[model samples]
Target: MIPRVPRLQVTELVLDNCRSSNGEIEGLNDSFKELQFLSMANVELTSLAKLPTLSKLRKLELSDNVISGGLEVLAERCPNLTYLNLSGNKIKDLGTVEALQNLKNLKSLDLFNCEITNLEDYRDSIFELLQQITYLDGFDQEDNEAPDSEDDDDEGDEDDDDDENEAGPPGEYEEDDDEDDGASDLGEGEEEEEVGLSYLMKEEIQDEEDDDDYVEGGDEEEEAEGVRGEKRKREPEDEGEEEED
Candidate 1:
């Protein structure tokens, strides 16, 4: 047993499999003025005579019931209905579905497993009869797949995409920072190599200067020895001249 909720606040209701011989549920009436969606499948409902007038109702599901006729009440009661499911019911012919033509806002209708589906040119005839319906039995007139009733989910997915797009620039900025860090590290390494090569060149120049100084000192010593040899030869020549005299 479901507890009674505040009728004014109720926007959606599901009473599937709740037995109601005359298609009326206790406490369900025009008092639920805000109701937008309703499901009463498998409820043993034989008629829509007792159904409430819900001007804002957009979706109604009465599948797997004994609802043989009286669909005209739907247009009068729920004029704004955008979707209606009468599958597995006793709808037998196109005329039975013609009652829905008054529902100008109806976009989709499902009558699967009904006797009317077995008729020749069923899909074509229905599309022709209900020109406003975009989908019959879950397909469009062009045989294209119909859109599902997950509008909120689609909005959520679009929000997620927007969030990702909003955060994209920050994510790219972080990657750019990482690249700049890498370039800074390479610059530091190059600086270190330059410092090391500068030290090595300084050491090589100092060693060359020391070698030049050593070579100059050795040449001065050899020149002094040659002068000393010339003086010795002159002294011997002078002694030989005195002896000859």
Candidate 2:
């Protein structure tokens, strides 16, 4: 049956995994003038040239697609877009960050598991240009897939009882068996590496007059050593995340 477009009332549109190759975005424009959310994840679209025209779009997700379109087009078009997810694509360089300057209202950006090799390259200044954005996933990777759910939404208590029987008893967390890094304590004696070299200086010298060159150099050396140790620990976690990707 051919689906007729109703009067522009669509607030959310999801075409995920549609295997759509052509840019049929124009079809929706005629019927979805009020569209507030749009998703074409894992679909076969490459650019955001057609989307910026959607003046009412608030959230857009086009991840896992082969998009090489310059970030300039996205920034120019979706000026009002607040949430954007472009991870799992081939967007590598930080030029996109520059293009996103027009997205002054953007609140969240997900470039996680992407081609950004070192976050330090765009950590403070470039990212800060997006003043409205509060959260950004620098890793360029695909997000976790949610588990399956039964679609029988109108079931009554009888169905609940039947489901209970079919699913068996309730499950519980195996808390005792799940001990890894362990929780960090933050009370009286909570001095870890986060305390920094300043902690050692204050402990040894009670007054400000004791800031000797030897003590200052020692603090600098220890701080550098501590930073290296932290980086070493972080590298392994990054590798694990890569494996998960």
Candidate 3:
């Protein structure tokens, strides 16, 4: 009902586990321009082309669906999207992935049980093509085991909040612990040893990689533009490229 972009500004939306038929999907509009993250896993998504306008989507989950067509179109529409889940689909081959070279922001891609049994038989190296993907569905279990980092980060924030409350205010009389220690260098070593700099370094690396691309390439993106442009040109040259962002 509202203007297209503002309504789809929601970052997270999950419509997974819905067991409907093809008739469920109706119309898709430029409104989904606001979604940075979305999850429609386990839904009956036989035609993902319904969403032809969600250009700013950063994360998408369409695993366990019955997707058969319009994958390249989906990739073009979701160029900024970094995380994708195509697991548990009947997509038997790698036709759609070739067009994904345009997805420069794609970070994590899931393709578990996609009927791609003979992956080596394909022309493109599944891993080599998506070299940037840090997390792949069928493999890369160790990286995926990092779900606990979220919990640990939460605890650290909570502790910081508690300390802030006890400290009263920013300018309140609070003894600088280092002043009483006589020498700042004296305790810095101990703190570093206690916290384990190794762990901190690992966390930093993980954080850097957290938002890094899990997939790469952009030539495929140009192809997407060509395809989309064809559709718009057929309607009106003036409306060929609407400012989606």
Candidate 4:
């Protein structure tokens, strides 16, 4: 069955791992004239001789292909391309990649798992050749934008230390505990003093009752003495009256 093709403007095309060759790209014809993004990864591509001319191409992913050369062709054809993924290819030499320096607007390049990635100082060499690249092998290798993981870790540790400092020391908690204990003890002492004062007041009340009883006994004795003296004076008056009669 003939497949139905959409009657729309094609801006992006992806044929990853489709076992496509240069013939498939060549057959794209003018239908993809406005294509800005293309991905043909793992498609066994060996050359760019018959690749369609995509003047407005901005990103290309040709990773995992058998492409050993022709980076210059891509740079010349896709001058406006900014991002390229050529990882996992048969690129054995940096010489082929040096040709991509012509892509003045190139910002990101991925050469991971490629033969050229094994070369010593390979990243430095690439950065030297492609000064405009901001990312290499999926990592930001730009001088100013490079991430300092160690510095970030140190800053995190310093922040943790600052938090601990703000929480104060263990000694302060111990001092607070001591102060609370002292206050509790002082309250207990005040309660004991109050109890003692109450006991003393009870004893004072008992002593006042005993003193009142002694004063009552003394008044009764004085009354008895006055009655006895009056009886003696009356007996003497009776003896005088009998003698007068």
TM-score of each: 0.64, 0.50, 0.52, 0.54
Best-performing candidate as measured by lDDT? 1
The C-alpha stretches of model 2 lying farther than 4 A from their native spots are 1-7, 22-26, 117-119, 138-245
Model 4, poorest ten-residue lDDT window?
142-151
Q: RMSD, each candidate, Å? A: 13.6, 34.3, 42.8, 18.2
lDDT of 4 by residue, 1-245 (tens): 98765624778888887886442354565457788888988888888776666788888998888888888887767788878999988898878998898998888888988999889989898888899988887676654543334346779999999988998975778878899999999999999999999999999999999999999999999999999999999999999999999
Whole-model Cα lDDT of every candidate shown, in order: 0.91, 0.67, 0.68, 0.82
lDDT of 4 at 14: 86
What is the Cα-based lDDT of residue 52 in candidate 2?
37
Name the better of 1 and 3 by TM-score. Answer: 1
- Candidate 1 lDDT over 1-245, as tens digits, reads 98878899899999988898556555587889999999999998888888889999999999998888998999989999999999999999988999999999998999999999999999999999999999999999888878777467689899999998987865678878899999999999999999999999999999999999999999999999999999999999999999999
Q: How far is 65's C-alpha from truth in model 4 (Å)?
A: 0.7
Regions more than 4 Å wrong, model 3: 1-9, 117-124, 138-245
TM-score between candidate 4 and the true structure: 0.54
| Collision count of model 3 | 4
Q: How well does candidate 2 score on lDDT at residue 10? A: 69
Which pairs of residues collide in candidate 2? 112-139, 112-140, 112-141, 113-139, 113-140, 113-141, 114-140
Of 1 and 3, the candidate ranking higher by lDDT: 1
